[model samples]
Target: MDDSLIIYVVASMVTVMAISCWRRRCQKSLAPVPSGYGKVFKSHLFGKPTIVSTDPEVSKFILQSVSEDFVPFFPGSLTELVGKSSILVINGSLQRRVHGLIGSFFKSPILKAHITADMQRDLQEIMASWRDDQIVYIQEEAKYMVFQIMVKTLIGLGPGEHLQFLRHQYQKFVAGIISIPVKIPGTRFYRSLQAKKRMMKLVKYIIQEKKKNNTGCISRDIIDAFLNDGSGQLTDDLILDNVIDLMIPAEDSVPVLITLAIKYLSDCPLVLQKLKEENTKLKHKSLEGEDLQWMDYMSLSFTQNVISETLRMGNIIPAVMRKAIKDVEVKDHFIPEGWCVLPYFRSVHLDKEIYDDAYKFNPWRWKDKDTAASSFTPFGGGQRLCPGIDLSRLIASIFLHHLVTGFTWVAEEDHMVNFPTVRMQRNMPIKVKRKNIDILLS
Candidate 1:
């Protein structure tokens, strides 16, 4: 080989090797891509092939399915924990019936009034225990208050041994919601199942007692609502499982929503001031010894905007899962039959293209925005949508009303933890002091 010929041969060899190496690197990088690309993609989630969608239109389609194309589904551990017979697991006509029975009662004006009163009383009691300059953990406090109110609303229990026992067992039950599916002895799943059993026994006893004491009265609470159902279709198991379902949010999403709102308000002073100003007007209107009605709280436009923005940024529920009963194609993304489909609300909520300055905590953005749009799914969307949406909003609004109106607080250093669940790193500590408005309320 001459010098020129050798140089050409060596350069060609080197170029080929570099190309091969680059090909291998690209293949390696693409190997474990969960979901392919774009707003809709495919992945294996919790051991099942899943179609993950961040597109609002596809999400709306999946959530609004009335046919067999999609059905409510959860991970194995969650399905087992909540039980196969849970309202969450059941589908079609039966699920609708149960949902309607509970949802109708939950949405009735009578229940709303009662819920507002219960929330106010519980919040006031919780806030009363806070002293000036005290560093209160807002997460824990909100959880305590929300749980008590939920207990009262569900089974009409109020601050006693029964309530205490249920709360203790509930902690154990909730611990396994996202754990491995194994139910062996000493496992979190096993303990949670046992907790559910204990909770069921107590709840059964309470139901019987409530039934026995009934004097043909109107429904006073959810227990009464269940008992008064003329359909005769609501069995003991149905009621027990569904009541447990309701408690999940009471301990998780609802409190977390309130906590996140507080965190956001703590970070956004101008937004907090506007919320306080709006709520303070309602506060003054209630100063004549009148309890604020359900409408009074919901009618607070700015407060609702703050709640909307908080939910937009918080993404408490984040994503919801469904099982495809049939192979479906959404916007060129194909979901195989029986595959899990997750509509990731968090993505859409935080997508900059969808919302200008999406990362910023700007409540004013919601002032003229369309909250009913497909992009927002804080409490979820469609038929299986959270029945407690109104109730949760009512609770948060009432809490903010009282907190911002009667007191001032400086939040301790904390940041949001999004994965595994949305929660505060330090449970959102705040040093609070009573404001001048407290005296007027007193």
Candidate 2:
């Protein structure tokens, strides 16, 4: 072939490839809906037409309506990574059975006891490592702390090289859960797939070990609870998938909330003062060296408000996806069967009509409002309401209680970005100082 002809051919191919890539990028872009499109607007996600809603009433209909018209619909990357048997991806009878087997475990008093002990010890250890004037990334440290609590309390796995390894792999897995679904070398999806395999192996080993030592009676830990139930309702694969699903979200969402709480408290000193006062008074009420009880956490009205406000602003779960099982009309918007429906909780959380000064960090706004209302759904709603809601709150509250009462911190940088999940751009670095005895005694 002539050299000129070859060069022309290469140029043409390059141009074609460039256009293809640009179109792919545009296909993934989700620009804000223009005004006059109503509360619900149609958009395309990965080439499929989807309905996106920012209305709380529409969100309620999609999440709670009992017509069997909609079911959970995760992205392709998540569906592949979480596995078919995962409770997050499955629906109908299996979901109920899986929920039945594990739901009680999450709500059990024994489980709460385990989490309390684990969280206190872990938080103390983490805080002890911080020194006055030292800079620490709260998001990174919070992830480590939350992951440790979940592993130890849920799977009965103690701190070790194995636990650390799983945490590392799980982090990578989560990073890839929402990436583009290509499996080519060096792609996030490919790495996530590898991480998923490693995590599954670790979880399977833990499950087998528990089964070997089972006494056929329910135990405080989730693994033993499933094994001892002996109903055989959950196969090993199902158990492993659900465990991964639960751990991935627990590791990310709670830590994001914790880190955001730190940011908000630092940004709003008056709110911090109120939070500190509430927590400090509780600390004074405790008998010397006595650990806090679950009731103690429950009574933290201001601290709980801080968490609610952080959840609202943080928007850890920006949206929940569901696919219509049949043709459904929500608020006069037609949604065809098989089309994706996204109830954007973040939109509702930030809606000016729903929240005053919606962008500002204000815990006081929650004082007079019902925090459990549908407008706030960081834990989601309906039958899929997070089984770990109470536990998540407990974890955040314990961490906040210890943090506000035990230390003083100033945010070095406070900027957050939310795409796959809400996270700090700088991982929320902060300078730390231990409170003096006089401050604690006061």
Candidate 3:
């Protein structure tokens, strides 16, 4: 009956009640409307009539629909920040043209090799800076490392003044991605727009320089891909818009994926041990001091499974947004013209009926499963599948290889937040110590 004890009990009760209320609210929002559409619901969202589908078949149909039927739809804040001409927003022939030019380059062997070397070298450099029992904020390290690699790939820039400046501006630009759409001074959106102008000014200079020096020559970076296209369809503004757009995924999803994998692995000791063993065996096979090739990394079957599981659970991109260009019916569900249609991938991914022990992180389950199945669309689907999917996977695979083989770490208290974006609450802090290679290999 002490006063302090009474206060503590009351606070606990309040917290429980708050959590219960939040859950109930979420359930109510997700529940189908009075039309009894089950997995499909009609609701007003983002100031428009919307059809939100959690059914995999319906979701797949919408994603695979032709551009004439459904096109990319983003919020006002995102559209303004991403630009009007970005590959993210453009549709039909223009979008296809850009997608073709970039997709081929993104999947080329040269690019893959470059990414592997850069990721390994940069990861090694960062890991080397870690001291024994140091509490490394992996979110920061992952961002630093991934951002540098992405900049190099995009513009062929290395560690120097230019990269640093872009990194600084990029942080401001990203801050406004989900901010209120006000362009006044001191606002997140305004700062983001200003930051973008600065970054684009630098990129424009780089493009001008590239045009002068490279011309028709094949440069390994993305700029080269744009420059060397014989079609003559791309303008400087389009290239600039797409470059800034591409940088969004670099700063957002890839680093988060790496951080999430580390977070999940830290919590699941058995899975971590198995993953480490797989990568360690690969390490043992390559003892000549030669850098591991892209194939070498890709061939790690179990490592790939872990990446698959991470993508499934991570759901870095929780939904695909599109506006119906015309009235359409998906799996007997009617979608009105010009309405926002969202295929909620997160709901499907976490469905208990689809994945056994759905909420659990189990990489082994992927061993017998087909990642190409409709149930697994982490990178979206159809022609709009993320072009950087391979690159993202390869980067993560290499990072995990080096991380598990070269060091040991204990993750600090942290949790993953899914809404807005999937990110670690505490920047995924971990105390890591270098592992002796001699002992580890043996």
Estimate TM-scores for all models: 0.89, 0.89, 0.92
The alpha-carbon RMSD values of the candidates against the true structure, listed in the order shown, are 10.5, 6.8, 6.2
The full ranking of all candidates by lDDT, starting with the best, is: 3, 1, 2
Candidate number with the higher lDDT (1 or 2):
1
lDDT of each: 0.83, 0.80, 0.85
Stretches of candidate 2 off by over 4 Å are: 1-37
lDDT of candidate 2 over 380-433, digit per residue (tens): 888788888788888899988888888888789568887445789899998888
Evaluated with lDDT, which candidate comes out highest? 3
Number of clashes recorded per candidate: 1, 0, 0
> How well does candidate 3 match the true structure, expressed as C-alpha RMSD?
6.2
Per-residue lDDT over 1-442 for candidate 1, one digit per residue giving the tens place of the 0 to 100 score: 3323433464456446534533444233222332334566555566676666778999999999874889887877799889776888888888888788778877889888888887888788778888999999999888888899888888888898889899999999998787666667777778899999999999989889988998757877777887887688778788889888789988989889999999999988898888877887788888867779989999999989889999999999989989988877666566778888889898899999999999999988987899889999887888888888888888888888989987899998999987567999899999999887666465
**Tens-digit lDDT track of model 3 for 156-266:** 999998899999999999988876677888777889999999999999999999988985877678898899987888899999999988998789899999999999899
